[model samples]
Target: MSAPMPTGVHYHQRSRELALTYDINGESQSFRLGAEMLRVYSPSAEVRGHSPEQAVLQTGMKYVGLKNITPVGNYALKLHFDDGHDSGLYTYAYLWEMIENRELWWDDYLHELKKANASREPLGIPLQRQ
Candidate 1:
């Protein structure tokens, strides 16, 4: 079984780069989010809504990056993607969870790409603007 993530993380300002403090766990991690990465990993319904089969393929996000990280509360973070996406609020625990399982998550992403028979070349979120 995987080890449980330590419950301690505080999101700081939304700067070009982000620095987080995990007090209880005595661990800290800093990550520079690329705009393309944010867009592809968006948690919005546009990227993850409807059904698994209906999941839209994301492409052309290599140039996309994170512009800012807005704190929604003590528990969540609203990422402002360079592509102008600012909807998904990654919870503190959620981010930690992702970090803890980065490899698995990355594998899943690759699997998604293969399932869709797509490439990693910057793809836009499949949702259309109304």
Candidate 2:
């Protein structure tokens, strides 16, 4: 089954959120997605790596922001993050999955952090380094 088409998409820089609206079964649904969530869960090879076993744990992205959003044909979005990551192609289906499973995914991320002894703080912060 294909994902529903997004009726609208908006990025609020001040709030660091991506607002997406979709029409599902004639009902309009909206999601407010955080920039950090998008960055850490990026579908790019840089984050996902060549295989699942090689997936990179993304830390220090607490303050990451979107630099640009570009359409990839009619299927996906190319997100340019403020942290200099521009390789992710976020498909509509993937985005919808992320929205629906956000809580579970967040829990997994937190678990990964705990396993790695990593902090979500922005990179290069003096306090976070300690």
Candidate 3:
């Protein structure tokens, strides 16, 4: 059976990160998600669905960066990527999973990018305005 959903909610915001905590039917839960991590793992159809082959391989995203984060209700969020993508609505359940399995996800991302000879860091990177 799946673990119960979260109840009480708390978000710990840092200068460049956000950590969340909650209780699900009395089960305590938590996740610490970095802005870069969130940007890389967005679950929009652009990143996830429309067929596995149709999935765009995100490269040079290490420099893409986060422009801003918008709330999409209590359970989701809308992220504006520095590359100009702002369509994904990431749910808490998904973010929680990403946080819980961060190592695996990160490994997979790197592996895929490497298989395509892609670089995580961009070339000719442009500076962002502070």
Going through the candidates in the order shown, the clash numbers are 13, 0, 1
Score every model by TM-score: 0.65, 0.91, 0.74
Ranking by TM-score: 2, 3, 1
Instruction: Put down candidate 1 lDDT per residue, 32-125, tens digits, no spaces.
Output: 3334444666677778676776557686554455566666756677887766778777766666666566667667877878887888764555
Report, for every candidate in turn, its global Cα lDDT versus the true structure.
Answer: 0.58, 0.88, 0.69
lDDT by residue (2-97, candidate 3, tens digit) is: 433444333333344555666756667766666656767778787766888778777776645556777776778777776788888877778678
Candidate 1, superposed: residue stretches over 4 Å from native: 1-19, 24-38, 50-54, 123-130
* Residue 95 CA displacement from its true place in model 1, Å: 0.8
Top candidate by TM-score: 2
What's the alpha carbon RMSD for model 2?
3.5
**Can you list the residue pairs that collide in candidate 3?**
7-23
Worst 10 residues of 3 by lDDT: 3-12
User: Regarding TM-score, does 1 or 2 come out ahead?
Assistant: 2
The residue-by-residue lDDT of candidate 2 on 21-129, one tens digit each, is 9888889988988999999999988899989998999998877788899988888988899879998899999998998899999999989998999989865653322
In the predicted model 2, the residue pairs found to clash are none
The candidate that wins on lDDT is: 2
* Model 1: lDDT of residue 51: 72
